[model samples]
Target: MNTPFPAIASSSEVRLPTGHHWLYGDLVLPESFSGLVLFAHGSGSGRHSARNRQVAQRLQQRGIATLLFDLLTVEEEHVDLQTREHRFDIPLLTRRMQDATLWAQSQPQLQHARIGYFGASTGSAAALIAAARLGSRISAVVSRGGRPDLAGPVALAAVTAPTLLIVGGADDVVLDLNEQALRVMQCEKELAVVPGATHLFEEPGTLEQVSALAGDWFAAHLSMEHAA
Candidate 1:
């Protein structure tokens, strides 16, 4: 899809309704975006994550819109820091993600747009579970150094969207876990390993590679003609 590239257009900050709490989201849409991707930030990260924001920007360059939000509220995040409780809570994260997705779909601008997910770290598990439960509504999923294994076997097998799991080759344990999840997934999927990266992809240019890989994946799948 050829597009007139705009670094960014106007975006809005939305308060999404969740059963437990209201989640904050930053929704950015280019003037002529083809799709919308709701981002699920990793454990201990929020809408302000530099890594996710970078990737979201890259997606924007590819003509895709993005919703980067806080999975946990400020109070909950503070509590988690003391208790180490919420960050790894897959079910909690999954439910919040679904709420965010439904909210995006309800938006006038995004209603007709194809939707995808960009998840990192433990957020990947939540993304997978939500995508599985949503079935065809979700068009694609991209996991960056994610823990899809945390989503468990049932969710992995139930997912039908095209999935791409990008892992850091040097992050052996996580790489192994992603591989295991890959084996269980029945969906059209691919595993991309970024050499010389750690779990955080903190190495210079490593994150750029991740953003590029994700941009391509979302661009390829988030299209009206790409059937769910």
Candidate 2:
């Protein structure tokens, strides 16, 4: 039986508030979509990053839509990389994610879809903070080798979305932080450690495991029709 869905590679972009632009990504949508999974890349990686693209492709293949946007404008990225200040601006990035979520909700292609978030590294912190602020607007969240601890106690406690945290077994420091943060999260959450995977999950096959875990988590949580 042929699955009613689009293949990987199709993607686009949209302009957000303040002239910021977002790469509206993923393989194209089938007639109907289960939900939208927006990607929040790590501190150094942007939307076009190969690792993130691979994960997004995997999600898109599973009938999910994904958006990988450059959180900071090019100019901002340059400055942030130079000064390293804006990269840790979790509050600002959270607000931007919130703005992007609202913008996504208004789009014709995604208007009726439940929204989910996929965040990595510091971006995970921003995603959690944004979920806390947006409340029921977001249905699910997944963090890959993330630093959700950076979101702070208030945001961690306030998040209500079902969340999945995928960490590297070999990355001891981040794993500890993720464990500690998990205790603070009042939402439905789980932590999975990929054996032999490092902080980047750059080890062969590790990223695939992360992607599969993320896809399953999002599908189970976001596919449900609920009032938000």
Candidate 3:
């Protein structure tokens, strides 16, 4: 499903202001990108996640843009590293996601682009909550080894964007959780289990599959053929 396209046009380090703090991120824009996907990494991860960067690169080849950002400030991340508190604070994470989306929408190059979210781990819950609140502003969502159940019943029921939940088949507990979340979600959605993969999807070719699936989902939902 990964096809060749023109080279990426830009890759930049960006700082997004949310509340009183600034979050840093890496933004990649392909030539004539069709959509923009904002990434919300799982707990303790940031823009430097190699797995996320791999997925983002695949999307770029499909003419989609990507933003991989830190959900917490340096000070907050430091404290959370010790207390393990902020990573599980879903409300705070959701606010950051929303703020990032708004910030993207205000940008000159991305203002008219369709938007999506690529979330991992606990960040998936934040992405869902933000999508539920933002409604059609979020055109699609993809979760890789995530905790969507943490979004709660109300938020799951309210999500309007089409969602794809990718879980490792070998991760029994998380697969069960994804199934539970799928049952409560009323929108267009699916659960894709990657065989032989664990929670981190570190198995051979597994992450590549995640990239292909996510790229296809975003391409379908965030088409450049129509106005967003």
Give RMSD (Å) of candidate 3 vs. truth.
1.6
Instruction: List pairs with backbone clashes in candidate 1.
Output: none
* Error at 165, model 3, angstroms: 0.5
**What TM-score does structure 1 among the candidates reach?**
0.96
Candidate 2, 50: how far from true, in Å?
0.9
Model 3 ranges off by over 4 Å: 1-3, 226-228
* lDDT of candidate 2 at residue 198, scale 0 to 100: 96
Top-down lDDT ranking? 3, 1, 2
Worst 10 residues of 1 by lDDT: 1-10
TM for every model, in the order presented, reads 0.96, 0.91, 0.97
Candidate 2 clashing pairs, residues 3+ apart or interchain: none
Which portions of model 2 miss their true places by more than 4 Å?
1-10, 18-28, 225-228
Query: Which tens-of-lDDT digit does each residue in 59-127 have in candidate 3?
Result: 998999999999999999999999999999999999999999999999999999999999999999999
Best candidate, TM-score: 3
Sorted by TM-score (best first), the order is 3, 1, 2
Kindly indicate the candidate among 2 and 3 with the higher lDDT.
3
